[model samples]
Target: MNPINKVSQARVMSPILSGLIYAFVIMFAGTLFTSLILLLTSANESNLPAFSYINHIISLLVGGWVAGKKSGTKGWYYGGMLGCIYTLIIFMIAFLSFDAGLNGRSFLLLCVSLLSAGIGGIFGVNSRK
Candidate 1:
């Protein structure tokens, strides 16, 4: 293949990588936004722990759908991975940031996050193609 062709192919691949990064950023921002909202409103901090995972799921689904529309299978896969990564990061942050007195709930949240990502990936991949 010509050098130009190789460069073009790389350009094509760049969007997928970009989408993955964007997805993670979106999820992270969404988490922060949700946390801020909950904090500002003084809305029962009791549920704050659960809200983090919920926000992550919503963000992942939206991001995955957008990525699918923009890219394709690669977008779906990367988007889902991004979601998983975002969730893991947020989980760590939450664990360290708060003393919510969680009892085994963190593990459950992780499982829920994984399931949500899987569902978002499937929906994105199948719906786009």
Candidate 2:
């Protein structure tokens, strides 16, 4: 393969990797902020779950958008794949660490993940000039 072609192919392959990195960074920041809020305020512990879902959704959306933008085509597909991969990773971690298993909630999360990322992907693609 031509050196230029190799470099370009590598660049194309990096969108998902970059998206995952960005998603984790965003999630970490959001979690840190949430933790600080919980520590500093009188927020009810019951709200923690809600905040976590919101954080994950937002993180995934942004991640999908980033992947879509980098891929510059089939944004929804790329974004959905990113979201699916992310969800699977999360599920595995929960399964291993918390003894969680596939259930109705897991299905719902998968749906939500796909939808959010798909929407973000559409937006990302359209946003490009």
lDDT score at residue 64, model 1, on the 0-100 scale? 56
Best by lDDT: 2
Alpha-carbon TM-score of each model against the true structure: 0.57, 0.87
lDDT of 1 at 111: 65
Model 1 residue 83 CA deviation in Å: 4.4
**Candidate 2 ranges with C-alpha deviation above 4 Å:** 1-13
Candidate 2 has what TM-score?
Answer: 0.87
lDDT of each residue in 16-118, candidate 1, tens digit only: 3454565577767887887788878978888876676666667666665555555556544655565566556766776788745445776675566556655
Tens digit of per-residue lDDT, candidate 2, span 1-129: 645544333574576777788888998999999999999999988999788888888988898888888888888987898889889998999999999999987988898888887777777777775
- Candidates in order: C-alpha RMSD to true structure: 4.8, 3.4
Worst 10 residues of 1 by lDDT: 7-16
